[model samples]
Target chain A: AQRVTQPEKLLSVFKGAPVELKCNYSYSGSPELFWYVQYSRQRLQLLLRHISRESIKGFTADLNKGETSFHLKKPFAQEEDSAMYYCALRDPYSGAGSYQLTFGKGTKLSVIP
Target chain B: DTAVSQTPKYLVTQMGNDKSIKCEQNLGHDTMYWYKQDSKKFLKIMFSYNNKELIINETVPNRFSPKSPDKAHLNLHINSLELGDSAVYFCASSQETENTEAFFGQGTRLTVV
Candidate 1:
């Protein structure tokens, strides 16, 4: 079974500090990883995807197939960056073959100004 | 305009009552999904539909049925809801192609007392 693991339940960082939210996955085939963010009282939205290899809102994640990790990182955290972050993995080989996404227990990020 | 939207941002109902949450997406994506966020903030896929066809149905109870009337709308109906069903339900849509990000709706908070 494909699984996504986000170890931290909560993370606090001061404004301008670096932030790293760890994510690991257990999947056999080539994986597609994504980071989704949900702000307070707002809908969840896609922050970035590993396959794109492009940074969004100063956040970037690299897929490490050997380690089975795709950690989200930002050089400078802002107060507005505080939100719930979820790491998801797409399973293309499910019984339905619909490419369902398996998300991790989200990590709440608190940026103190 | 909201790309993906779910009705009844908050729902409070009795344990035995039945309720339905409606979702619609104007993104014109081919795939739509229902995800549940538990008390621990763990997100999991409950169902997936592509072009109004059932594609992925997770190990959810039969009481939980997803109906997609058209390509743009997917509704989730829960029968004899239990207290354990108290959680936030999200509606999301995405293109079936690779590297495309899924768009999500502001979740519906369902409290089954």
Candidate 2:
């Protein structure tokens, strides 16, 4: 079984404040983790992946294997950072039974000015 | 031009009706997927196809069927739709390897009246 858990339904923070959205997963096999963001009136897009270890739009997420977590963080929240963020994990194998993804319920981040 | 596109940006229908949503990707990717976002904004993978072959079906109901005529297109058809089926449906695609950040199309908002 594979699952992703996002404990926070909503996270509101003032501009310039740091923000963190927590995610946890349970997968039997090696996993590929991703963070996706959907802004107002915009299509859902990939923010970053754990494999890439890259930061985009001032946001970064660290995958903590010990804690079984992949929490997204930003040092300074901007008004434009408001969006729905989803954490997902894909089975690494390409075979018929293992190529799909399991996604978290998602957290809505509101950056208040 | 849009890299990925899904037809019927909005659909309103009564329960028990049948309908289909078409998706196409112009990115020449070998993998395509259909995802359902519920009212609470949880996105779940319903189906995945690789190179026109069914690769993943995430315990979706038999009423929901996905067809892939080619590597670039995947369509979903639902039978005996229920009010529970009302949600936002998204189409996505990605390359098989290197560049695996999936690209999503503008979602189709389906409302069961």
Candidate 3:
């Protein structure tokens, strides 16, 4: 079974400091990876996808096939960056002829000003 | 207009009662999905429909039924709701293919007393 793992239950960082939220996955084949974020009292939103290779809100995630990871990173954390982050892995279910996203438990990020 | 929307954002019901959550997507996507977020913030896919066809059904119990009347609507109905069924349910839509990004709706927070 494909699974996404976010080892950090909570990460506290100072504002303007670098931030990295770890994410790893277990899959048999190439996976489509994504980072979803949820701010307090807000709905979940898509942060970025590996295939897009586009950074959103100054955050970037690089897919490392060798490490089976797609960690989200930012040069300087901002107060707005404090939120719950979820890593997801999409697998193609040939039997169903569709794709399914498996999400991690999520990590809460706190940026102190 | 919201791209994806779920009715009754907050639902509080008693155990053993039946409840339903409706979802609609105006994105014109060919696929829709139902996901459950437990109290621990762990997300898991419950059901998926592609072009009105049941594409992926995870290990969800039979008590849960998903109905996709059209390509733009997917609703979830739960029978004999249990205390363990209290969680936020999210509806999402995406292009019915690989490497596609999903658009999530504001989740419906279900509280089973």
TM-score of each: 0.95, 0.94, 0.95
Over B4-113, each residue of candidate 2 has an lDDT whose tens digit, in order, gives: 99999999999999999999999997788899999899898888778546754647889999888777889999999999999999999887674268899999999998
Each prediction's DockQ? 0.65, 0.59, 0.64
How does chain A of every candidate compare to the true chain A by TM-score?
0.95, 0.94, 0.95
Clashes of each: 0, 0, 0
What TM-score is obtained for chain B in each of the predicted models? 0.95, 0.93, 0.94
Model with the higher DockQ, candidate 1 or 2: 1
DockQ of 2: 0.59
Deviation from native of the Cα of residue A82 in model 2, angstroms: 0.4
Query: Could you tell me the lDDT of residue A68 within candidate 1?
Result: 98
lDDT tens digits by residue: candidate 2, A9-75: 9999999999999999998666799999999878999999998888899989988888889999999
Give me the runs in candidate 2 sitting further than 4 Å from their true place. Answer: A94-98, B56-58
For residues B18-103, write the lDDT of model 1, one tens digit per residue: 99999999999888999999988888889888853586454799999988888899999999999999999999998887767899
**How far off is residue A67 in model 1, in Å?**
1.2
Of 1 and 3, the candidate ahead on TM-score is 3
